[model samples]
Target chain A: MSEKIVITGGTGFVGTHLILELLEQSDAELFCLVRAKNTSAEQRLHQQLAEVIQGSDYAPELINQVKKRCHAIEADLQGDITSLATFIPSGVSQFWHCAASLNYEERFAAEIYDINVEGTRKALALARALNVDCLNYVSTAYVAGRNTGVILESPMAEVQSSNVYESSKVEAEQLIYAQQDMKYRIFRPSIVIGHSRTYHAINFSGMYGFLRRLIQFKGMMARVQRGYLERESIRMNVDPDVPINLVPVDKVAKQAVAIARSDSSNTIFHLTNRTVPTVGEALEVLFSTVGLPPPKIVQDTTQYAWIDEKFNEK
Target chain B: MPNEIFVIGTGRCGSTLISNILNHHPDVLSLSEFFTFVTDLGTLIPQAFPAIQINGAQFWQIVSGIYAKQNIMLAHDIAMKEVLYPFKTDVRFNASTGVPAILQTTLPHLTPKYDALFDQIHTVITARGMATAEAHYHALFGWLAAHFGKSIWVERSGGSLRVIERLYQHFPNAKFLHIVRDGRDCALSMQRHNGFKMVLLVFQITEILGIDPYESDDRSWQDDLPDELISFLPESFSGKDFLAYDVPPSLYGHYWSGEIMAGLDVLDRIPAAQQLTLQYESIPNRHPQYH
Candidate 1:
C-alpha cells in the first residue's frame, strides 16, 4: 500500500498549490480535507493543477498521473476531529495543518480562538490519534505580531497586535510548541502572493487587493476627474529599508513539500525572500505599475496614518 | 447636525461619485462601502452578545440579540454624534469597535426582553472600551434620527440594491436613492474596474431568478465573469449559456436594465414619496433635490 498523507485545509490557496507540488515528488496517496460545501474541490484541484503543469510543459500523461494520485475528503476543521478517525484508519505517515482564518478584521476573539488555536489543537490531537510519522504545519511569519526587526525561526513567546488573527496564530504556535511528544515541522511564510509567472489565483493580500482597489479608484477617477485629487506619500516607523518579504505561492508550496520530504531535523524554516523589498521600493513599484504618480515618501510615523487610512478606505 | 446621505446602488453604477459629492457637502458625513460590517458580522454580533448562542438561535434571534446590547446603542449614538453629526473630522474611526458598541447599547433598549443578557454583555464590552464599528447606513439611520435629531439620513452602499427591502424593513422612514448608469458604460466600466466578481454575482443572481442573461453583442461573457460567479449559477445553466450569451446587449444593457427594473419594483412597493431615482450622468449636472 502507498504511504498516506492527510492535508487539512487543502481547498485553500496554499494547500491547493502544495498538493500539486507534492504529487510531482511522491506517488503517495494524498487525501485533502475540504469543506463539505466545496463539492468541486476535486474539479478545482484538477483545473488549477492542469494550468500549472501545462505551463511547465509537463506531458499529458504526467498530468494524469498527478491527478490519479490525489483524492479529496470532505471535512470541516471546525468540527470534531474524531470524525476523521475512520478516514485515516489507525495511522497516517504524514499530516499538514494549513487551515486558518486570515481575515485581519476578524473581531470575534472566540472565532479566532476557535479556528486558529482550537483548530490547531484539534489537528495536533488528530495527528497523535492517527500516530502519524511526522506532522508539518504552515504558519505565518507575521506570527511575530507587532514585533519588528528580525523575526527568527522559533515559536513566538509574546504577541502584540490589535489584529485577533495574528494574536490567535501566535497562540496556536504556543500550543504547538507546548506539545513535546509530537514530532513536527513548521513553515512560517510571509504574505504569499500570486504564482510567480501568472500572478493568478484569488488573491486577497498584501499589495494585491490594495492595488486592485487603487486601480478601481483610478478607473472611477477617470470617469470623473473633477474632484481635487490630492496624492501624497509618507514613510513611517516601519523601516523603509526593511524588505517587504512576499513569497510567491508556487515557491512556498514547492519549498515546503520538498523540505517535508527531506530528513532534516530543523523543526522550522522561515520560507521568506532572503532580500525583501523596502516599503519605499514596494510603494514606488506599486504606484508606477498602477499608473499613480510616485507618492512623496515622508519619513515620519505621523504620515503613516494617511497611507494606513488609504488601505482602510479600500 | 451634519447631513449625512448615503446613495446606495448596485455595483458599478455611480456610488463612488455619490459618495464623493456627499463628502463635498460641508455638513454631510459620507462614506464608501464599509464592508467590515458584513464581513465581520459573525464576530461583531457575538462580542456584543456573549451570552447568546450564535449557532443555536434562529437568524432573527441572533439579529435581535445583537441589537439589544447596550454598548451597541451607545456606539450608535457616539458614531452619529462624533462622526456623522459634525463634518469637521476627516478621520474615519475603525468600524471594529463601533459596530459592536452600537449593538451592545441599542439592542437591549430596543428589545428590553433580552435586557438581562444584554446588560451582562454590555458590561463586558464597555469594560474593554474598544471602539465599535459604525453600522452601515441602513442600520444606523433610525438610531441617528432618534438620537441626533436628524430627519433624513442618506447612505450610499454599492451593491445595496440587492437588499433595499432589508433596509426598508430596518428603517421604514428611510428613503432610497437608486443611481444607475448607461448599462453599456457600466458594463464596460465593470470590465475595466476588476468587477469580474460583481459581474459574476449579477449573472448568478439573474440565473437563479430564471432570467436569461444573454445578449447579442459578445460571446465572451463567461470569460468576462469570474469562476466564483459561474459556479453560483443554477446547474441548469451551462457554461455555454454564459459564453454564447450576448454581452454588449445583455450584460451591458438589457440584462442590467432588467435587474434594475426588478430592484425598482421592490422599491416601488414602498410609498412613491420614499424613493428617488437618478442616473450617473445626471449626478454631475444637477444638485440633489431634498424634501
Candidate 2:
C-alpha cells in the first residue's frame, strides 16, 4: 500500500513547486488544503497550477499526474479548522504545512501574526489530532535575523528579528519545538527565486521586484534625458562585500522533499546556495542585463545624492 | 483695552529685527513666528484657512505638528536663520522625530526655556473644547497676553504678506502693519535664503506641471519633467542639495513684485485706521519717531 500525504498552502509559490516535486518523488496520493468559498477547491488549485506551470515552463506529464493522484479540500486556517480533521483522511503519514504571510511592515503586523504564527498553531493542532507521524514545515532562513557570521542548522537561540515576518516565524518554530506528541521538520530557505533553468517566476517579488523597479527607473531616465543613465550611476544602499544568499525554488523543493523522505525527523535544514554573489557583483549583472550603468554601492546615507534619496523613497 | 497687531512683509525684509526690537517692550507681548506656525510655510492659500470648528486637541495638533516640508528643512539643518529652536540642546524632539511647529521659532525666540513653555501651553490648549480657528487663536493669544502681564500682543512672521488674505479673513477687526522694502534688495536677500529657494522651487514646479506634485498623487507626468528642473523637485532633492543649488536673483525679484501687488490688492480693502505701511530702509533712521 502507498503512503498518503497532506499539504497546506498549495496555492503559494513555494508550495506549488513543492507539490510538483512531491508528485515526481513518490507514489503517495496528495491532498492539498485550499482556501476557497464560492469556487470549488479543485478548480482553484487547478487554476493556480495552470498559471504556475505555464510560468515555470514545466513538462506536460506533471498536470496528468496531479489530476490523477492529487485532491483539493476547501479549508481556511483562520476559521473553524477542527472540521479539517474530518475532511483529511486517516493514514496520512506526512503533513506539510507551508502557508505563511510575507508582509513585514508594521501596518500588516496583525495579519502577519494571524496567518503565520496562529495559522501554524492550527495546522499543528490538526496534525496532532489526526495522529500524523511527522510534520514538515517550510520556513525562511531569515528567522535567524540580526545574527552575523556562519549560521548553524540547529535549534535557534533567542535573537532579535529584523521584521514582523521573521519574528512570527521564530514564534511558530518555537511552537513546533514545544510539541512532544509528534515529530517535526523545519526547512529554512533563503530568498527563493525562480527555477535556475527557466528563470521564470509566478511571483515578481524580492530580487525580481528590485529588478522591476530598476527597469522602471531606467525607462523613466531614458525619457527624461537620452543617455542620462549611461552617464550617471544609480546608488544602492548596501555593503559591497556582503554576500546575498539566494536559492532557486526547484533546488529548495528537491532538497526539502529528499530530506522529508528520509527518517530525518525533528531536524532543521538550510536551503541556500553554497556560494553566493556579493552585492556589487550581483548589481553589476543586473545593470548590464538591463543595459544601464552599474550602481554605486553607498553605505553612508549622508552622502546620498538627491536622485538616490528619491529612489530610496520608492 | 488690549490691542492686537500683525506685522506683515515678503520676508528677508527687516521683520526679524523688528520682532526682536518689539520683544524688549515691557507692555507688549511679542509673538514671533506665530502665524508661520499656524499656516503651512507662510502660505495664504485658501486650503490653509479652513473655517471648520475643531476641538482643543485638533487645534493643538494644527499649531504643534511640524509639516513635511518643514521636517525636511529641520532634518537637513537648512532651516532659516530666524529659526531659533535649540535643536542641539532640546531633549525631547529632533529633526527625525519632529519638533513642534510653535517650538521651531515662536516659543524659543520668546524664552530659552521653551520646553516648559510648551508644556504649559499644551496643558491649557488641549483642555479647551471645540471652537472656530479664529476663536481658538484669539483665545491663546489673549491668554498669553494675560500670563505675561502685557496690555497688547503684536505678532510678526517672515513672508507673512503672502498670507494677508488669511489674516484679513480671520482678524477682521485687528490692526495691520505693512513693512515695505526695495524689490531688488529683497530679491537679493531671498536668493541666498534656503527656505525661500525651496518655496519658489515648489511653486515653479506646480506651475510648470499644472499639478501640485508634492500634494497630488498623480505621477502620469513623471516623464514629462524637464531634466534640468527635475533635480530641484521636493521629491528628488534633499534640503542640503537644494540649499547648494543657486536660484537667480531675477526670479526672486519677479516674485517680490507679484507678492507686493497681490498683498496691496487685499490690504486696500481695509479701513485706513487698521493699516500702517513703512519702508524697510526708513526703519533704522525713523525708529525713534515710530516708537
- What value does the lDDT take at residue A11 in candidate 1? 60
**Mind giving the per-residue lDDT tens digits that candidate 2 earns over B1-291?**
368899998887777777778889999889998777556575334445558888899889888877766666777788776677866656688877867888888888777788888899999999999898888888888888887889888999878888888888888988988988888888888887877877766665554454666567566544434455576655776655576677777657656766787789889998999999988888755453222
Superposed Cα deviation of residue A77, candidate 2 (Å): 1.9
RMSD of 1: 19.3
Give the count of colliding residue pairs in each prediction: 37, 0
Model 2 has a clash total of 0
Task: List fnat per candidate, in order.
Answer: 0.00, 0.00
Error of 1 at B171 (Å): 36
Q: All candidates' TM-scores?
A: 0.51, 0.53
Candidate 1, A23: how far from true, in Å?
A: 0.6
Candidate 2 residue spans exceeding 4 A from truth: A37-39, A213-231, A288-291, A310-314, B1-291
Question: Across residues B1-291, which tens digit of lDDT does each residue of candidate 1 receive?
Answer: 233344666556776567656555544444334321231211232232233222312322333332211223223332222112111221222232333322332332223343344445444333332222223223333443444345444555445665565556545666567787777766565443322322444434433332333222233223223333453333333444434333332233333544465577678787777767787777555443210
Q: What is each candidate's DockQ, to 2 decimals? A: 0.02, 0.02
